[model samples]
Target: MSWRPQYRSSKFRHVYGKAATKENCFDGVPITRGVQDNNFCAVNPRFLAVVTECAGGGAFLVLSVHHTGKVDPHHPRVSGHRGNVLDVKWNPFDDYCIASCSEDATVKVWEIPPHGLLKNMTVALKELQGHSRRVGLIEWHPTAKNILFSTAYDYKVMIWNLDCPEQVIKNPVRTISHHTDVVLSMSFNVDASLMATTCKDRKIRLLEPRSGTLLQEANCKTHKASKVLILDNVNKLLTSGTSRWNDRQIALWDLDDLSVPLLEENLDGSSGFLFPFYDPDTHMLYLAGKGDGNIRYYEISSEKPYIHYLTEYRSNLPQKGMGVMPKRGLDVSSCEVFRFYKLVTIKALIEPLSMIVPRRSESYQEDIYPMTAGNKAALTADEWLTGIDRGPVLMSLKPGHPTGESDGECEKDQAYIRDRLIAKNGGKTDSNGVAGNGGTTVSNGQDFLLCSPPKTENELRVKFYKQQDEIRRLVDLLHQRDVRIKQLELEINNMKNSQQNSLEHF
Candidate 1:
């Protein structure tokens, strides 16, 4: 007799994907036609970057997330690459910082301005040159500051320590154990201590990234034909590729023992490459093909049948590539757990699809959202380079949770609302009414009334504008902190150099 239930029970079974309308979609973008297998789009909470087709050296467009709809034809871009931009990744800790790899055999890091680009950006914040051939993949350390990894056609993965003020890392501090062939994809463990990579040679190798030691190697029937793979949260490896019969298949493997797969399943025949995106927080794995319009999601567990099929998000238009938003970037208010930026090459559009868990109440849904990783890094580059391991700082999705950011701003906004209400009403009132010109009455001490919502549409509009202003202020504050960090770094470096010279002279 089977010990498990016939049908699986999960709160996320009812989760559905919601696509934004045309007005909400990013339009008029000549998305890159690069033949690269990597996603050409990258998004953060504040900005979105898309590799665009250019007539000259490679260029990528950066726009404020709010600047949606038809992009301005003359909008500024980061246009310094001598060849096509292959991949772009945002800094896990800093919203304004981003890194890119290109066919020019170099990697560049860029720091976006506070309000986004206003003119063509040719100067890069930091440049790294070591790859003999085109650099194709780049990923920032998950828990470390300014530690980056770049894989190139040279079949080498280089680790970069970018803690300098504003200078080039002439070469990587060192290279990881070299791959026999091109590294197709790369993923790091939670603390970035270990790295898993799938290579062109059709083999999956796990390495202690810092020491460049191959801890485990898997060579089986699945390994021979697999094209893409990633390391997930549960200490398991998930791969998607074609099978012997030319059918698309996915397999799951335990990191400890990769001699045989724990589970393997085959899907329909498709020639396009399948891109596997995993959300460690929700334990959800999404498989999207390059030329398919459907996105299939599955729940991953450590128990039997580790991978459970959730549902598919289908559309009429095929996707050229897709970008996923980080957990901190999601809209917790809407009960959204995941968001994807699908690049439609034929229509030159990037559509956003949000995965939402439906809820009756508008309040925060704690069940769907556990504490997630914040923007702050848990380890510095030096600390990580010295083999220190620490988990990412966790933050609540609830509003005003003070995840490193000051809560005083939120309190000040509440104070402002209270002052406005008090000023509007000459005296105190009750929850039943607000003291207004033949309108409503509000209580004196109450900053806001939950029972009586914004009665008039005009009042609601006022509240909306106030909220927008508050958002802008918060954004500006974040930008100010970014600039301050840069200034402080420069000062610290100068002081260090002066002290070294003084000590030598004495």
Candidate 2:
């Protein structure tokens, strides 16, 4: 039987209520300290798993999210890490299982009993210890159940197969050493075929998890470091970091190119790190920064200037840490498109912010509704470790909708110009004869070709100068041709005169 509380519990306070008539707001449960960005707080898709850490204790709580803002007295908690629990993640395939990274330089995998309750702090079922420094980030594979990845201050990324059972350091499935500096954030693509990492060295790299090989890398070219997030469409990546001048900016990059940002937006020069939350179904991106009271959102489309500014959610208090609930956990019936758990340190309160699409119609709009990824493992841990080429079943942005259809017809003159570029400079192919996108292949059987222009301004300038020199040389040759034509005409006239004089003498 499932665990349940016997006695009545006090109702949690709501910052804003319908009867109060002041504003629409609510407060979350009090936390020990502000949450960190490195997977500190995770809410599962089914609203079954909610994990958070306390400021004072090196422990975390697995809250019962079914009853908002209320914790069952009999509910179990997780308390194993020695130092601060920096990050925690709910397994995509298993709601009961969770992985956490800590300042103690260890990653632990914990599972809740099938009966649905842990009465006290417990040790992790599997302990992964390899990092010599604090492990700040932990992420689970989107498609695989037992596969986990962690990043630490040691500038290394380790892939773990929790099914191994043995807690040994020398037997990690794969150890990635591509980053020269500490990796700030990492994420797997929609299908889990490619993994991208943003490091403090101002570089973003894409790696193949199967072989732990570096597929491609892009220089952020900025001093400030931020996290990287893969778009739901799996074709692009959204990055938020400091600009060259030390200003905060968010950029949307095409995964194929990575050299030039498809879109770039500058924001306030605040020192807080900008955390990007992207909703694939709606193509909406929410930017929440540390130490800021406002959450800005934008609409991303395939059109030019791909990112369009939408609106911002503001409050009186700044947030120390923030957590975003999965799409499946959202109250879609109420037209809630996105939900955010904001941790405010001012009054030691956590607040819930819901982004709803205001609709006047009474009918349900499945198009606007978010169809979140279900809790089903496409591949097991053992299968992934053995190099299975399976990918996660990612939902489309506009599922059930037809692609490549236009409502109206336009002539060639009215259509926008499409640019297709190719690099002819010493291009080489891999063993598979794929030369583009640095020989990278997507799980969808599509090849990503690198067709972007020069990345840096210096490179663009050099190309421009070389083109100008070619034009100058071409003009000089044209002038020489004109001079040669004139000289040839004069010589022909002199030869004709000599021939006429010889005929008169005969």
Top candidate (TM-score): 1
Q: What tens-digit string does per-residue lDDT give for candidate 1 at 148-178?
A: 9999999999999999665777778779755
Candidate 1 at 232: error in angstroms?
Answer: 4.9
What 10-residue stretch in candidate 1 is worst by lDDT?
A: 438-447
- Each candidate: what lDDT? 0.80, 0.65
Model 2 over residues 329-393: C-alpha lDDT tens digits? Answer: 55544566777766665654556677777666645567676455655567787777777756555
The TM-score values for the models, in the order shown, are: 0.80, 0.68
Q: Which ten residues in a row are the worst by lDDT in model 2?
A: 412-421
Residue 267, model 2: lDDT of 91
